[model samples]
Target: MARRMVIIGGGAAGIGAAGAAKAAAPSAEVIVYTAFEDVGYSPCGIPYVHGKEIPDFTSLFLAEKQAYADAGIDVRYETTVLGFDPESRTVQVEGEGPSGYDALIIATGFDYKPPGVPGEDLGGLYYVKNIRRAMEWDKILDNVRHAVVVEASPLGLEMVTALAHRGIDTHVIDPHPWALGELCDPDIVAPVQESWAEMGVTTHWDTRLLGFTGDREGHVRTVATTDGELPAELVVVATHKVANNALAVAAGLRTGSTGGLVVDDHMRTSAPHVWAAGDVCEIPHGVGGLPLQGLTGSHAYAQGKVAGTNAAGGERAYQPVYVPWGMVAGTWMIGGAALGEVAATALGVPHVVGKATGISRARYFPGVRPVTVKLLAEPRTLRLIGAQMVGGEGIKERADFLALAVRKGITLHDLASMENVYSPPIGALNEPIVTAAQAGVST
Candidate 1:
């Protein structure tokens, strides 16, 4: 009999694992089970569809159900896995009996952290997940006049912009002093915050949600915050994403402080013949070796590849992560990699900061815009530890490069003298990254 590989969840990580496992062992039996009705779609695109930036939700799908079937992969949708026993090497499906497997991969992903306030169970409260429900909610948003987002998290920021794009009166409430304060420093985030204000979005900074009040229909009508009560017709809880690890914990898998499953360099769990990936598992940060979770879909898929390849009896090692994140806030593009000033201070990592404001193109260029770069380095060795950037066209590229530079142990001296492209339209003569590093070197 061929070896059987069972994967739980059909999100990015699970899909990645299935594909890689099938490729590693062509004759192996690969099966995937997902509680959701759909698979092979980008969850990251959900907010865009809601914002009408994309024409429809169907465009979010990368592949159809038939595509998986044609690849000789059995994808069981809307089928929940009740539990699994590592000792028995069996997975218990909700309706089906136990299915034996030679190897197992758990990529159960994340669930929204509950608001934990009163009236959370009321209607008109939304947690953005499940494409099917988003499709349904997209229609309802057309009629919503006022919406309040619970936090200023990444998803919260996306939802805020989406709602604003729909011309709805949007309000964002957060305990943080500024948007994305947990990640980017205040100065880097200031322009984005201004952009939100220009969009007619109201921000309640340093304010906590007290509770909600509903109308006769049990739908949210008012948002009560420490600041005051705001009339609201809808509420979105976009708080931190907690790992959905009930199944993993029940199966006796070790989990980290981040509530993500603990896995080795090979993505192997504590139990033999089992691996975990995606938002469900925590990996060490490249700089401080701190465990982190709730990362982007790209990270999930890469980790899945390592897990699947190893489960198929192949050799592959997953490396520590220097998470490079970038996104548009209102109209400003801002991003960072590894640690910023705030994060470094919070983590107690001693560092020096270099900052510079340079043009994205030559001074004579038509559409030149200011690009600000900030580099963080260890004070003694001047080794690059993290970076943050906000600009018009080059934020994402610079953030990605800095992540690699940090990984490779690039230092202030290296970037200060680094060469860059120079053109009238696309390239700038003075690279902000190099200038920022020079600032640090001079300091």
Candidate 2:
């Protein structure tokens, strides 16, 4: 008899696992259970849908129902897996009905936590994490003239940008001194702040949202921050994310110190014949193997592949999870190691870095905007450790090269001597990567 492989959560990781498992064991039965109505929609595109960047909400679907069926993988939508039994190797799924599985893969992903401040449960308050929430907010956009966004992380910034594009009076409030505090340093952050300001997005820095005020109808009217109160027709809380690991915990699987399911290199959880992926799994830190770092789609997809392959009687080892390099808004692109302050301080690298705010292509190039690049290296070791870049165009690709350099432990001298294709219309004679490395070496 063919083995039965059950995968939970139809996000990036779950879908990838289902596909890989079917390929590895052609005779095996692969079934994916998703709580959402849609199976393979892109979570990252939620902001774009809100901004109308995507023409329609359905455009974010990565795969259609027929696509999964074509692969011979059974997809059960609107089915929530409540818990699992390790001894029986079965999962308790709720929605249409309860079901059982021989082997299970958990990839439930994460959810945003609205700030616990008063009036948070008001009608106008929102947090966009999935397609349903995005669609709901899309309708609310027509009624909202002003919106206040709490938190300025990537998701928060994206939502604020989308609101501003819709001509809504948008304000972003964050306790951090600058936006993307975890990704970029102060030098790189300044240009992004300036860009947001130029776009007419008001910012409240170094302040916390204390509470909210409501109108006579009990709808949120204004946001009360530590600084003051601001009028808002809608309030969005985008503070932080928590993994959906209740099923894994209920199955008697070991959880990480930070609350995610603890999995080994093979994506195997503490329970036998069970695995976890995506946001529910606490992947190892690239630098120090630390736990609790955020999980991205790329990491989830890779982990799922490993879990699926191994579950089909194949041997595969997943590599260490690293920080992702990708684009966000059209103008601003960030790429770097998402290292903790603890790691930075432990390295104790006294490196001198130079930054330049210039055009992406050339000053004469059309549609070019100001791009900033910051490089970090240890002068004594000459090893390039970190770099951050932000710009309107061509910054993301360049940052990828820098991230590669850091991952390979490339020295400043090596990067200085590296060759790069360049043209006045396309790129600089000395690329930002080379220039930044040379600057680090000189210092």
Candidate 3:
């Protein structure tokens, strides 16, 4: 009998798992089921498309549904999996009978946390997910003149920039004193906030959302905040990402403190012959083995590959995450790996810090931009615990290097002595990372 491999969800993780599973078990009956009508599109790029940075929504798709069929993997789009019976080893589909699976991979992604205030159900409110809905919203944005983003989250910031670029009066409301407060330190994000302010983005900081008010047509007309009422033709609810764990919970799978399915190194769930990946599962952090969830798409894909390979009777192991994250904030770029000062403090990890400001290219080079690097290390061993960088051009590369360095137990001394490229066009003679590490060593 051919082994049956069933995957739920069609996001990065689900698709990744399906491909790896088919490769590992050539003859396995692989099926991927998703509630969405479309697959293989980049949800991350939705913001850019809305901002008119991309030409069209069609450009975001990586592959068509027919392509999966050609690869011998069954993709059932617009199909929902209602529940799973762990004892019976079967999943109950919404419009089908119980389907048995030799192996199951649950990659159900995330849902935006609701604002949970009055008039949230009113029209003119948008939640940025599901590319189809985003496409519809993109059309609606053409006529919107005033908009308010309910949170200063990554998505919120992106939407703020997008709306402003379209000549709309953009407003951002956040109860926190600074943007991305949970992910970045206040000082590091100050410049990005300043740039947005310069761009004419009205920021309502330290203000709580009281509720939304609607017009006669039930479209949002005003955003009532702790400060006062602000005119808004639309509201973008860009709140926190919460794991969609209803299926996992119903199936009796054990979840971690982060409300994500508990999986070991092999991505195997508590149930036999079942695995979980992506936003639905919580993995340990490299810094202190703390459970972390709601990571980027690359992490989801990699976790899915491991889960799929293992579910197909192949051996694979996933390591703890040194999360490397980067994104353009207003005019500048910001990113970090592992812990930042904010995260370290929140997690109660003791650490010392070193930081430096250097040019991205040679000082005399044209288009040279300032790059700031901050390194955190254990006080005793000086081992690199985390790093954060904010700059014009080199944030991504530095973040990637520091992620690996943190994982490999590289110390401040190692980075300080590390050789770097010194080309005038792109390479800098003085690397900010090395300088930051040298400062750490001196401390």
Cα shift from native, residue 29, model 2 (Å): 1.2
lDDT of each: 0.93, 0.76, 0.92
| Predicted candidate 2 versus true structure: per-residue lDDT over 1-443, tens digit per residue | 88999998898889988988888898889999887887777878888878878888888888779998999999998876777788977677764354566678888887776588888778888877668877877998988888999998778878887887788888999998887665556666666677678778999999998999898899999999988999998987887778877777776789888788888888898888888888887876555566754567777888889988887777888866446455564247655553423246555635656455556676676876666666666658777666677777776676667666667887888977889876667775657667767776776
**302, model 2: CA deviation in Å?**
2.0
Candidate 1 TM-score, C-alpha based: 0.98
lDDT tens digits by residue: candidate 1, 26-128: 8888999999998888989999998988999999998989999988789999998999999999999997889899999999999999888889999999899
Highest lDDT, which number? Answer: 1
The TM-score obtained by model 3 is 0.98
Clashing pairs in 2: none
lDDT of 3 by residue, 53-161 (tens): 8989999898988999998899998998999988999999998999999999999999888888999989999998899999899998999989999889888878888
Query: CA lDDT of 304 in candidate 1?
Result: 88
TM-scores of the candidates are 0.98, 0.93, 0.98
